[model samples]
Target: MRSYLIIGMCVIFLIQYFLKLQWLEYTVVTLSLLAFLGSTLKADKFPRWLGIIMMTAGLLIEWNKDTGIEGISEGIFLILPLLSLITLSPLLSIPLRLGGYFNSISVLLRNLLLHPKKLYAGISGTLFLLTPILNLGSVRIINEFLEELKLPSALSAKGYIVGFATAVMWSPYFASVSLVLLYLNIPYKDYIIYGIGFSLLSLVIGNVLFAIWEKRHPLTKEAGVKVPLEKQHQKQLVKLVFFVILLIGSCLVIEHITNWSMIVIVCLVSIIIPLIFGIVSKRWYELIPRLVDFRDRTVSMLNNEIMLFMSAGMLAFAMKGTAAANGVSDFLTTLAHQSVLLFAIAVMVIVLCITYIGIHQIAAVGALAMQLNAVELGISNISLALLLLLTWSISTALSPFSGLNLMVSRIAGVSGVQTGLRYNGLHLFIIAVIGIGVISVIG
Candidate 1:
């Protein structure tokens, strides 16, 4: 039954891509949601209220003339990370434990010293480092850090939450970069290397700017609160490490042997290998049930709303088959002809804005790259790809609405609005300056 649903979803997706039918695309999304919900129900973990919310949102989005399969696809893509977050409990526990130790000490010392700036920065920075280690790692670390430091729980949590909006700027292992590279037909290694540089720049500059800002405007202090840590059985930690190492090794091997997309490779590792191995295990009953439970929970949280949003992409693609969204590209090209440097700046700014408005960096960057075909721009593919990489780094790293940002925020116990308002402008400025300089050297 699951296999049938998977096959059907893929067929529908392919049909939408090839035939571009709005109604068919809508049906595809609807069926995909049904399959997801059905699985959740079987697991007895379905959240009806959240499912209703997703359905309503999907309907509203579909009602809009501009919303289609293309839009819906983008929506689905954007929500993958969000869904990943919901399912990350099993995966994130280890890193969180490791980072929590440091958080606790930082929080306690800062409170004792009565240095709010240092306290906030210390907690935030520690959580930031913890983010790339695991899914909910940052949150676990921050919560523990706050408790150990004897700082107010609200302040510590809020600071940790805000830090999520910034961590993706540095974490190269994130799914966003992987997705963008896949969509754009770019090499993952190129993105990984370039992203490392961009991520470091964004992190350093963003932290410095935020630190300076805090010195200028002080907020009220609050009392600390304590929460119990989720204990990880030693066996689970060992197994988790084994799984992660295996997955990473598989990716590197595939990257060497085939030019197939990183997303495909990731899905194979994240979803397929586990399923196969679990079935083969003597403890299949236990392992399979747990894996299914994780998948159902993740789908329940992320799939419905994303499927609804993806319907928009279907609709858009239905309306215009071969002609991509060229408005932004045309605008950029006109500016590029005037000066490549200006073109690079304009692209970064546009990507930044799109990201702020809650668009995923992959979609924003990929769509822009598609529209700005190198053939049309009289630029080498490598150069255009590099520019896209830079823009992606800036947008994904800085945008509070991004998946990485939201994940960090949730873990840190803060709202996206708070994080965005606090860090967006400063990160944007730094990325802009650094982007122009980097592009000049590369060009």
Candidate 2:
């Protein structure tokens, strides 16, 4: 029954995309709230407290304007499509796992690993390349390999956090980029162009800082150990690279020809490409049961992420309808008049501060987007988008309550606040300073 209802809601969500009717959005979103509650009661799977808070806050904020019900409901409706995409990601992950391609490369990288620095670079490098296709699913692959090799937990954790954050800034497929694009209305091409340089700089800076930090580690001396790659490893890696390029190329071409948004293209191409490969390679039948099991189990992982963002979207809308929101708009416009540099700095501060208190960056972005979006602050859309992306990435790395930090904490067997938050505080500060400087110049 639960599965059936989930399917029904997804179908309605798809229809709502084309219909674009407010009433339909309200109906589906209301059903989603009920479904969340029903899932807890029916399946013994409670919604995360964050989700509950988001949904409730969205309602209260909207009620302040007499539109909380429909407004928040429609907000849920907006994000449900993304929820469907993320929860359904295992459809791609399962095939990659079964094919032994990603794992083979991961194992190869591990085997060739020398010292802390190489390991840091290797792990971060692999994640940077693979994250576009694998999303968060890549974390488990990297984690399992690191554990098998008895790698330093902090090294791998820091490497992964940086790599993943860097990738999310520019990846057309990432929810960060997608959400920013949705709100900013910037061309995806422009986003990629502006972000590529900054993204690479962030990744390079992070890995270099990580290497410097490793000087205190005992294994820094072992970085030069000789390890040779076998012919088979070389072959497999090349094939995997080609496969990734193929997937990316297809998505880019389709997006260019159709003029569809990158997220929409990503959602479609991620499914189509893998499905065709599975069938053509004759792995579809054998992988079907495993895929089904993965879906049933892992789809629940999205509950927190989906709930937080949907609720944030609702509150953003609710805020938009209020006189206070109007007042904020006027104030921000005044700031814009004072200086674009100041406006950009203010945005980073607001986002960073809100995220520090366990509020999702999206909530901050959504809350301020309307006000900032309407102002002509001499900042390019791409600049604002990149700033938000970097801020989101940095905050998640340092926020103990962030989903990624919590997950990394569990994997590293450390306190989320102490290890994930305190450990990365210095790196985040550097990023914050450099990032704001760059935004000031560019914006």
Candidate 3:
């Protein structure tokens, strides 16, 4: 029931984008409200309870100011695109899984890299490049391959976690990037150069750090897996790479021509590319059944995200022009006076602290972004976005309660806290410092 409501909201959003009908807009909000009702009770305890509290506070504040119900409606509508992205992006995984794309690539790589160090670098490098396209599916694919190896859990965890988490700094497909872009109202093209540059810098730094860590904790002789690689798997790997490049190029061209929001464009492309591929590859017979399976299983899994984002939207709207919002601006402005670097650091620290306590980083970012005045802070919208993106990327690796770390912990056979704080903590700090310097220079 909840899945249908959420999926219906996404469909209406896509329609409303093209039609620009006021009636459809209201219908989207109505569906959103119904979905929220289910999520508030069904979502995880932390976000579910936190969302309720935030929503209640937002409503009270709006009512007190006499903006009444209309203001509340507008607030919920503000983040509808983000909610749509979360619900729809999972559709990409369907084709990749059914087509055996990741499995083929992982198997081919496993057979080719027989040395432990070579395999480590190969896995990390592949994951870093593919994560922008595959998202968390990239990590799961690599982790499954690693489990068959005689490698230590710590080594494998470090390799994939850093490799996968760093891409969010710039990947347009990442929810973090989308959230920052929406909050700042900065175009993707304006932000892409810095995002890509900083991400490559972070990747280089990660590789160097991983090498250093590897030297101390060396792998045993049995770490290598020698198996005959199939020709078909190699062909599939090449096709997968070509398709990823094509998908990105297509997205850029369409965004330029249509001037649509990146979120909408990505949602459209994600759906279209797979269908086209299925037909072109003569796999059309399996596509509908796979999509139906995804609809039933995956759409229902977004309960926590749905509740948190909708509630965060309400709070962001209610706080606008309020005294509380002004206080946040004033605080950030004072930090800017000292040094813009300090302001960046302060923002990252606040996000880190909030996420460390088990709350998702999106809520922290959504709440603070409403109060951030770019002009007063003496930074362009693009610069602030880069800083926020860095924060989001770093927090994902450091926060034990984060879905990324939790997933890695489960696969790596270690404590969740160890995955974040013990293994990746110091390395993330170094990357954060370097990232801040790059943002300051570019800003």
Candidate 4:
């Protein structure tokens, strides 16, 4: 029942893209609030409590201002598109999963990435390429393969997870990048001009860190099963690469022609490409059952995310135009005028600190973004977008409470805090110095 409500919300949101009806948007907001209520009992303790607090604060603020119920509803509706993007984007993995190519690719990776350092690069590098399309699903797939290959826990944990973080820095498919782009109102092409460079640099920095860490704790025997890489698996690996390029390429081409937002383009491409693949590959028979299974399982799995993001939308609404927001804007403006470098450092520090204490990056970024003015900060909108992307990547990598870290902890048998502080803590220092340099140069 709750799943249906969420699905209905997404369906209605899609309709609004073409129809542009006010009633359709209201329907989405209504369904979203209902879904949030239904999922609250099942959501994780932290998001559950945090959602309640944020919702309460938002409602109280609205009440004090006498904005009435309609005004409050408008606030919640403001971020509904991002929610739809998040909900629908994960469906793209279903066709690939059902096709069984994942097994073939896994076998190929295991046979190839035998040495410890090479394994680290392979794990992180594969995830870097795939995470943009698969999101958290990539982490689960890689970690499942790692369970059979016996590398040290640290190598397994940091390699793939950090790779996932690097993708978040630039990928239009990620909620982090989409949200920042939506807020800043910049074209995806403009942001990607700088973002792709930053992401590539971060990927190299992550691999270099692995090299240093490898010296301290070396693996004597080569990891992974040493079976011959089969021809079929090699073909499957090539097919996977083709699929990623096709999907992302389709999005870029369509966005250029249609001028749709990246999130909407991703949502549409995620669905259309899979169906087209099923038909072309002669696997049309499998699509129905797989899609049904995906719908049933995916929404329940997203209970926490649904609740948290809906409430975050409400809080973002309440925060705008408030005295607190004005004060933050004033302070940030002054700090930027004093020294733009410090302003850049301060942005990353604030985001990292907030996320460290169990606040989701979405919530922190959403709130902090409201308080910022790009003109006053002496930064271009694209540069500001890159700065936020850097912070999102770093904080998501290091925040134990972040969805990525929590997922990694569960798969790698490492505590969430340990995954962040123990593995990525030093990496964070190196990234900070490099990130500030990049921001200084660009901003």
What TM-score does each of the candidates earn? Answer: 0.61, 0.89, 0.92, 0.95
Whole-model lDDT per candidate = 0.51, 0.69, 0.79, 0.79
Over 1-443, each residue of candidate 4 has an lDDT whose tens digit, in order, gives 77778888887888887898988877887888888888889998988998888888887887777788787878777677778877888788877787677898677567656577777887888888789878888888877776765667788678866788888878888888888888888778777757777777777888898898888877667534487878877788788888877776777788788889888888787777678867888776787777787689886778788777777767767777789777766777788888778888888888889878876777678776666779878888877777788888888888888888888887768998889889888887787788778777777
Across 1-443, the per-residue lDDT of candidate 1 in tens digits comes to 55355445644554454476778766766666655555444432223343344344454544464665566555454333323322332333323233234434443434433456666665555555555444344565455444444443334434554354344533334544553454456766655556556655655665576567666766555555433323433344345445555655677678768865554445444445544555565556556555565445533444433332333223222222223355666777787777778887787777778667655554456456445666566555556666666666556445565554565455445666554444454566556687677765665
Off by over 4 Å in 3: 112-114, 148-151, 223-225
* Evaluation by lDDT, superior candidate among 2 and 4: 4
Model 2 off-target regions past 4 Å? 19-27, 39-47, 68-70, 220-228
TM-score between candidate 1 and the true structure: 0.61
CA error at residue 188 for candidate 3, angstroms = 1.0
C-alpha displacement of 165 in model 1, angstroms? Answer: 5.1
Give lDDT: candidate 3, residue 205: 75
- Residue 362, candidate 2: how far off, in angstroms? 2.1
Better of 3 and 4 by TM-score: 4
Residue 153's lDDT within candidate 2 is: 62
Candidate with top lDDT is 4
Q: Taking the tens digit of each residue's C-alpha lDDT, what string does model 3 give over 1-443?
A: 77888889999989998999988988998999999988877798877887888778877887887887677767777778888877777677767777787778677667745565666667777877788876786887776776666457777678777888878887777888887887787778777888878777777777777778768877666545466668888788877777767767787788788888888888888788778868788886788887887688778878877877787677767777788677767888898877889999999998899888876676677767666868888877877888888898888888887878878888788887888878878778898898788768766
Q: Please give the RMSD of candidate 4 to the true structure.
A: 1.8
Clashing pairs in 3: none
Ranking by TM-score: 4, 3, 2, 1
Q: In angstroms, how far off is 438's CA in candidate 3?
A: 1.3
